[model samples]
Target: MSILTQSAAFIARSCARLLAQDCLLCAADSRSSLLCTACADDLPRLPADYCPRCALPTPAGEVCGRCLRQAPHYDAA
Candidate 1:
């Protein structure tokens, strides 16, 4: 590896160690990330029956009505 890459990585690691971040939800120290491990784990997960295109909840996991009428440019959310 290059000397510059190694030096940059070392500096980044030092900065990460020195800096402590707070979680958005609980305001606890998360250290480099916005959310702490516990708060991140407690967050809600998307349901299985969501639209593939727009990520909206669907009854049968099919495309949502809105997407059907006016399709989005992206294939998936």
Candidate 2:
């Protein structure tokens, strides 16, 4: 029947979608194909406490001591 044929086509398309997706940032192959899990995990997340100038990780709520005493020579201080 036409209804059964339509159902079959729909099922086929759905199956195709289920097979894979692409990585979001790089447009690379992906198991999920939408910001693949590894790429998502690799994304840089800001730590709670980080270097004021460089944004590198720092001990939570603590400055690196040297940075607190005086601005670096190049800091335009």
Candidate 3:
């Protein structure tokens, strides 16, 4: 990453350490981030068998039917 971006992230982390922040979802103490660990982990993740092109859930983990019929502009989702 760029130096400025890195610096900004460092400063943000430092500030989070100094200030007690509440989780945006649960209103619990999150400390270093906007979401508590439990809430963060509870968030939905992409399915393991998702299509690589469109990120739609696929039974065989291959490209979805939509992408196969008409390809997406970009590559992997």
Candidate that scores best on lDDT: 1
| Runs of candidate 2 exceeding 4 Å displacement | 1-25, 29-35, 72-77
- The residue-by-residue lDDT of candidate 1 on 1-77, one tens digit each, is 89999999999989887876889999998988899999999989999999999999999999999999999999999
Per-residue accuracy of model 2 over 45-76 as CA lDDT, tens digit each: 88888776555567874555667776575642
Tell me the number of clashing residue pairs for each predicted model: 0, 3, 0
Across residues 8-55, which tens digit of lDDT does each residue of candidate 3 receive? 999988887788899999999988679999999999999889999989
TM-score, per-candidate, Cα-based: 0.59, 0.34, 0.61
> What are the lDDT scores of the predictions, listed in order?
0.94, 0.70, 0.92
Q: Is candidate 1 or candidate 3 better by TM-score?
A: 3
What local lDDT does model 3 show for residue 53? 90
Please give the range of 10 consecutive residues that has the lowest summed lDDT in model 2: 68-77
Clashing pairs in 1: none
Model 3, poorest ten-residue lDDT window?
12-21
Order the candidate numbers by TM-score, best to worst.
3, 1, 2
lDDT of 3: 0.92
